[model samples]
Target chain A: MNTLGISVDAWAAWAPGIDSPNDWNAWLAGDSCLDEGVKPNVSFVPPMYRRRLSLLGKMAVLTAQQCVDQYPIDSSLRLVFASRYGENARTVGILNNIVDDGSVSPAAFSLSVHNAIAGIFSIIHNATEPSVSVSAGQETFSAAWIEAEQILWSQMENADRVLLVYYDEPLTGDLTRFTDDIQIPFSISLMLSKSQSNGESICLQNKRALDSSDSSLNESKLNQPLSFLRLLLSPEQMISTTTSNWVWVKNSANA
Target chain B: MSDLIQEIKELIIEVLDLEDISPDEIVATEPLFVEGLGLDSIDALELGLALKNKYNVSIDAESEETKKHFSSVESLAAFVTSSR
Candidate 1:
């Protein structure tokens, strides 16, 4: 119901075969497609710490690192990580272990929580500022955006930026029947600051406020994060996506 | 004894997901935590579970002897041998 203004200072995204800005630009133009069964290379991470990361965790951390590398934020920058299904593969492995032998690997169980990736990121980067992990089914990206905006608005003076990371992978094995939303594996990180005059402004709106026949409205075939990434990449001014109870209309601030 | 020591080294590598390091690279007399292999507490728990499952050796976490037994591959091999 409330309209908030913010600017994305910098952003970086990573998918299976999509790494560079050129690759994303090509993907946005439909010139290339995401290659399956490929994972992001995170060899820069120390082996001891890297061993603990699952593929989903690796994707999230890789994007976060790349985003921060572009903007060069200090350790004080707050973090908001959102995922529709956090570490699904690791969770499934633990569940299968339970069903098989009545014993679970302690390391797997320890890192199974939703906040594990965020915690690891903070530890690796020495970020002492507060961090929040969010998951709201299909509205994960939008919810995380709202959470970041709230943090900035609530602390207008001290908090200048919040790093928002969104990531998810398609459900595999027997869990694939539950949702038709996510079909790819990708992670997107946006470094958001308060809206500035010259920067690209973004505003979130409830879809019910607009006229039903508005021609600017476009539906997305991809999931929430990917759809939002498409909005970011394309020349289009607006995108409308819906969950069961909520329909969010995100558009350029001026549009 | 050497074969058991080699087996414990391989177990550490497999249980901790040490993808880069090989069995020969792990010194039997060197420490397994913090200094040598640089494993953390979580890895310790994981290795303990693995040892229990593979060797049927129970580890008493509260005991000081447990710490010594897990100090190195040689100590772990000795512990496993004695337990058997």
Candidate 2:
């Protein structure tokens, strides 16, 4: 089977609500909170492309643009976007209006779909590339990454490359409190190529889930994105049997 | 007239998440883009939605003239007042 090596091209994160680790630590203790300056508004985004976008849309596009700028790729490359909760803010906002005022904003209604981010990306980038968005609840992280790897692996038979972008922002209101216990706002993109790695390579190792009483699987308190992130980006000393997201396979420097 | 501009300035500050900007510092004719306020395209989209929600003004974003209206908070307020 043909395998593809993936490397991190660019990652950008913007967290609106929390300003410090102390605030984030408080969130881990299960607190329904709001960050004073975390809300996404239009002034932060530029004017030429600001005519059509939501808060979530802005974040996704910015991260994707960052990736494109960092690594110049063919506009025809395939892409995969994954997000858990998938536009829950727009969902709840529409639901609130329907229940209270019997009306919904047209933009909000359209953006409520799961593929909205992918669609927006295709437009802003002016790329007619094939793309798909995925939402698999708690299994979102593993499923999305695995799918991207599989796509790259398949393309490697023809020596093709693909980009995988993973992004998720916590929803506003009380629901965020019930969900992510940490304020881990992040967006990570991995550009997978049939070519060999330069030095830092990320390897996706598949292993059987052991029968154990792990708090992550059982408790709703664990934030999957943050948990997976810590393990994925952890240093060698930080590696522990307790965490198993993915192992980084390091080899040579590009230079 | 200054009061209306001040009010619009406050609205811009609130909607755009401008942490350090004060209403008094925003001049009426200063550019709101790269030169003055340094807002980008994404901020325009979000703040446009916010303006619609707050003032009940119909922002025909599909039109090209909307660019001139967003040049400054003064123009935006004037546009809103005239449109109403």
Using DockQ, give the best candidate's number. Answer: 1
Give iRMSD, candidate 1: 0.6
Worst 10 residues of 2 chain A by lDDT: A234-243
Instruction: Tell me the docking grade of candidate 2.
Output: incorrect
- DockQ computed for model 1 against the true two-chain complex using alpha carbons: 0.94
For model 1, the stretches where C-alpha displacement exceeds 4 angstroms are A25-32, A211-213, A242-255
Worst 10 residues of 1 chain A by lDDT: A244-253
Candidate with top TM-score is 1
